[model samples]
Structures are given as structure tokens and as C-alpha cells.
Target: MRAFIGMDFDKGLKDELNGIQKVLKINSKKGNWVPSSNFHITLKFLGDISEEQVDAIDRIIKSAVVNTSPLSITLDKLGYFNIRSNQYGVIWIGIKGEMMKLNAIYGIIEKEMKVIGFPKEKRKLTPHITLGRRVILDLPFSQLREQVDHELGKEFLLDNLTLMKSEEIMRKRVYTPIKSYKFNKILEKNHR
Candidate 1:
């Protein structure tokens, strides 16, 4: 089965993101825009893993997340990945807030996952959710960035990390969380 690890968005965040996507779609009119149901923050992309691998991954995640308290991430800015010369596609919204905590969890997952065969990421995590692929618009992506560059409606509370299953239905990819591992460890209260 195809599987990976990621975090889901709340309804309000999803709605807000959908509205942003709506405007981008209307403006660009050319791109593989992600469906709202498919919106998520990918922590790790495990292309295809066996059942045994899935079990191992679940164990790794559960063990690692137990030490982690809930984290908050904000929607910071609009950005994109360069697809070709002068064409920067793969539009996305960047992350902010409680980033150190997020990075710590990512590091733990990377270290454990690598022991089982997953390759370590060459580049550091950018921490963004892709909104569109192969995007084409009259103006440059830099120009578009200026237009949609706004702070988040609210911060995201990540109480859990998920092991997700990826499936193709009617020629479209659908992501569903098979298991969720919550971070229930208590943090020391800060005293003034």
C-alpha cells in the first residue's frame, strides 16, 4: 500500500485555504489545483511501503511523538518551487510559529525512518502545503506572491501526527489517515 506521514487541517483552516485556492484558480485558470479534501501538511512522503513497513513506521511515529507536546504553526506567506526556466510553479503557503518543535519531530522521524530504508532528505524541510502544480499565469509567481501575501486567519494546533494511506480513485489521488498518534506528553509550565 502507498503510505506516508502528515497532518490534517481543521475545518475552518480548510475553508480559509479553499477560499485562497479559489482566487488562485480564477486568476491562473491553468494548474492541477489540489482538492480541499486532499489538503494536508506532509511530514514525510513514503512513496510505497509494505504492510510490515507500515507497522514499523507506526511504531516509530508513536514512540517519537509521545515526547512531543502539541505545536502551533501559522500560515506565513505564498511561495512556489521552480519547475523550469523563468517558470516557478508549485504554489504553496509557508509555515511559521512553533517551528523548532516541528523540526524536532521531523528530525526524530527522519532518523528512525532511515533505519528502515527511507532515504534522508537532502534538503531541509520547507514546511509548506502545495496549493497548485504546473501553474501558469500571465504574471510571474513573484508578482502573484505579492498579491496573496497575507498573514494566516489563525494558527494550526497540531495535537497529532498521522500515518496516511494514499489511493487512486477515478484517476484522482485521495489521502486518508490510517492511524493517528497523539502527542500527550505534558510540558513544564512556564513561570514568570
Candidate 2:
């Protein structure tokens, strides 16, 4: 099955990103825009794994997230990623605010999943919500980069992590949540 671990967005946050996508579409002439309902921030892309491996993955995820607290992530900043040889494959909104906490969660999942034979993440965890994917690679990115308005400044509480199944419907990719794991959010405020 095609699978991954990710978090869904709240309605208000989704609306904010939807607004961002609308703007991005207006500026760029070449890209496949992501559907509003498909908006999510992936924690790990597991690719294709067997059902048995998924069960094991679930165990690892549950253990890793135990005692983890909810975090507030603010989505701000617009950026594009280079896929290969000057091809900017994806445009995303960068995440900030409470990133250390979010990184802690990502690290726990990454480390524990590795123990169960999943390959370790090669790159540093860059938390962002994908907005659009490039269809044509020949366009000058610098011009398009300047055209996009990237500051989104939307914040929301993230309380659950989900293991998702990806499937294509009507030529568009759709994500279905297989299982949802709630963060046992610690309520203590740190005294500094």
C-alpha cells in the first residue's frame, strides 16, 4: 500500500492555505495545484509498505508518540523545492512556531521507525504544507518566485498524527486516513 505519516489541518488553517493556493495559481502559469481537502503536512513518507509492515509501523508510531504533547504550528513563508536538475517540483508554505516540539515528535518517529527497519531520513525534517507541484520544468523559477506572495502567518493546534493511504481518484491523488493517533498532550507550562 502507498502510505505515509502526516497531520491534517484545521478548517481555519485550511482556509488560510486555500487562500495562499489561490494566489499562487494566479501568479504561476505552470503547476498542478493541490486540492484544498488534500492539504496536509507530512511527517514521514513511508512510500509502499506491506500490511504486516504497517501493523509494525503502527506499533512503533504509538510507542513513539506516547506522552507527547500537542503543539501549535504556525504556517508562514512560501518556498519551492528543487526536485532534480533545476526542476522546482513542489511549492510549499514553511512551518514555524513550536518547531522544537514538532521536531521532537518527528525525531522520535524517525528513530523508532528506523529500529524496525525503515531507512533513516537522510535530510533534516523540513515541516511544510505543499501548495502546488510543477508540471513544466523549463520556466525560470526566479521570475515565478518573485511573483508568489509567501507570507501566510496562520497558526493552529495539532493534536493528532495519522497514518495515511494514498490513492489516485480521477487523476488526482487523495489521502485517506487509516488510523489517527492522538498526542497525549502534556499540559504543564514551563517555568523560565
Candidate 3:
């Protein structure tokens, strides 16, 4: 299954991002917007793995996240990926606050997965919500960036992490939550 772990956005935060999408849509090219429902900040992208490995991956994830407390993440910046000639890949929302803790969790997941024979990811973990893809126009990237920066200064609480399956739906990629794990401090306190 093609899977990964990520933090989902709350409804209020989704609405805030949708608002930014609306403004960018006015003068933006048709392919420049992503469905707001698909927005999420990925921690790890565990690509295709055998069915036999599913149980081990679950146990590893549970061990890594069981003790950490829920954190608040604010989506405050706008940026692009591989912006050389034109922004072809993504326009995204950036993250702030409690990022160190998030990075630590990602590191633990990467480390544990390596012990089980899964190859380490080649790219560094960059925490951002992908807003759109296949952008084909040279619309004022700077203006769009500035607008997103001004309007999307909202914060949301992240208390849970989910293991998600990414699948093709009518030729478009969609995510489905397979399992969700919550943080419990009492469990950690006892462990220490």
C-alpha cells in the first residue's frame, strides 16, 4: 500500500486556506489551485510497501508517537517548490510553532523504519501543505505570495496524527485515513 503519516487540518484552518484559494483563483490559471480538502502537512512518506510489512510499520508508528503531547501548528507562510523557470510543482502554506517537536517525531519514525529494512528517504522532511500543482502560467508569483502571506496567519491545534493511504481516484490522487494515534502523557511519564 502507498502510505504516509501526517497531521490533518482542522475545519477552521481549512476554511482559512480556502479563503486564500479564492483570491488566488481570480487572476490565476486554471491549474493553479488544489482542492482544499486535500491539504495536509506530511511528516513521512512511506512509499509502496509489502502487505507483510504493515504490522511492523504500525507498531513502529505507535511506539514513536505514543508519548508525545498534542502540539499547535500555525500555517503562516506561502511558497513554491522548484521555482526556476515557472512554478510547476506546488504552491504551499508554510508551518511554524512546535516544529522542533514535529521534526523530532519525523526523525524517530525515519530511524525506526530503517531498522526494519525500509530504505531511508532521500529528500529532507519539509513540512508544508501542498496547495496546488502543474501550474502552467507566469502569473505574478510574487503578488500571490504576498497575498497568501498577509491573509493566512491562522493557528490550529494538532492533537493527533494519522497514518494515511494515498490512492488514485479518477486519475487524481486522494488520501484516506487508515489509522489514527493519539498522544497520552501518562503513558510516557510511566515509561520514563
- Per-structure clash totals for the candidates: 0, 0, 0
In model 3, which regions exceed 4 Å deviation?
Answer: 185-192
Which window of 10 residues has the lowest lDDT sum in candidate 2? 183-192
What is candidate 1's local distance difference test score?
0.81
What does the lDDT come to for candidate 2?
0.78
Off by over 4 Å in 1: 85-87, 151-153, 185-192
TM-score of each: 0.88, 0.84, 0.87
Q: Name the better of 1 and 2 by lDDT.
A: 1
Question: What's the lDDT for residue 189 in model 3?
Answer: 61
> Which of 2 and 3 is the better model by lDDT?
2
Tell me the tens digit of each residue's lDDT in model 1 across 1-192.
898888877677777788788767877847888999888888899998887787889889898777788888778888788877544478888889999988999999899999999999888988888888888776776767666766353687767789999999998989988888677744223210
In angstroms, give how far residue 38 of model 1 lies from its true place: 1.2
Local distance difference test values of all predictions, in order: 0.81, 0.78, 0.76
Candidate 3, residues 1-192: lDDT per residue as tens digits? 898878776677788888877766664665556677777788878888677887887888788777788777787687778755564577777888888888888888889889998778888878888777766544688777776677865677776577889998998788888877666665336545
